[model samples]
Target: RIAWLKNYAGIDYMVPDPQNPHARVINPVLLNITQGPPNVQPRPRQNLNILDHGQWRHLVVGVTALSHANKPSVTPVKVLSDKITKIYSDIRQFAKIA
Candidate 1:
């Protein structure tokens, strides 16, 4: 996973922090994108050609977190799809209100 991250995700170097031995610190640039409300639709799985590293990471992390949050019953793919639908519905409602 580390090699894949370094090669494909453009994460050059990840080293253990001097102060916190257990914590690893990656290149600052990889942490450029801030956490916030969802701003873009996750790239469709059928379209695996999308080269946006940030979006890919976002989708993977979001899906993983959601799956973990509702574990032991809900499937990961189902959770991700349901979340995507809900996000779109919320966006539409917000737009209507605005």
Candidate 2:
């Protein structure tokens, strides 16, 4: 699958907060897709897409928060999809040479 992210200005990324040194963000805003013949139960935490649009937008609070809130979590899926696509392409190339 393919996905995309549209930054219409006023969006920000996660950064280190000096005031709250221990308040680290543990959640990743990406969908972790896994591939295997040995499908494990319960799966890895990284293999799940848990963030909703609202939660995702809240990652960067600002005057343009509404813009973010309306947008879906596309970064993670897009990134993961690109990686998977490259893997498949590599496999295909290998098969052609073999």
Candidate 3:
């Protein structure tokens, strides 16, 4: 995965997701969670340098596959300011990114 990302998208060889980690990167939080191996963790994601420049109008995460019980959890991306309460139902669910 690292090789492919480096070759194709040109992502830096450092940690990809600062919040998550894989075999290629060690994360302190993950170590505490599993007490060891990451097999119990979410599926590791290969870095996508193509999305690097922060130019994507929409950031799409997760797979289209039937909600895999073993993959990463669907996280809520903040689409509005914290002060803005009562977001539309559809937007809060991440469906707006679609």
Candidate 4:
């Protein structure tokens, strides 16, 4: 679940705009991880794991006869399987953030 990102994590970046010759080039020093932010609630260790990998979400749909035209002829079990497959495709689209 771990990956390297510019040496460390937490969305670090540096701008090298030469227009400002006197600008600071060094990284900022911060307090140790044990330090607390006075305003925000303390995050759980599970949150750090989320940073390592994107979150997974699942959506499920149950088949019903209301949407079907051949309710009497089509088996409810087969309808459910088709509905589940469509749900999976929807999930894939959602994962793409479209």
| For model 3, the run of ten residues with the poorest summed lDDT | 61-70
RMSD over all Cα atoms, model 4: 19.8
Clashes of each: 0, 1, 0, 0
Model 2 local distance difference test score = 0.38
Q: How does candidate 4 fare on TM-score? A: 0.29
What Cα-based lDDT does every candidate model obtain?
0.53, 0.38, 0.33, 0.38
Tens digits of per-residue lDDT for model 2 on 17-51? 45788664421332233434545657564432223
lDDT at 1, model 2:
16
Model 3's number of clashes is: 0
Question: How well does candidate 4 score on lDDT at residue 26?
Answer: 24
Which whole-number lDDT from 0 to 100 does residue 46 have in model 2?
49
lDDT of 4 by residue, 1-98 (tens): 01221222221233233567666342222212234554565664443222122332211221233223224476766665665565556555545442
lDDT by residue (tens digit), candidate 3, 10-96: 233444454555535532223332354635556777554432435222332221111121123543333122112322332456533
lDDT value, residue 6 of candidate 1: 51
User: What is the Cα-based lDDT of residue 51 in candidate 3?
Assistant: 27
Top lDDT model: 1
Task: Work out the TM-score per prediction.
Answer: 0.31, 0.22, 0.17, 0.29
Question: What is the TM-score (0 to 1) of candidate 3?
Answer: 0.17
By lDDT, is 2 or 3 better?
2
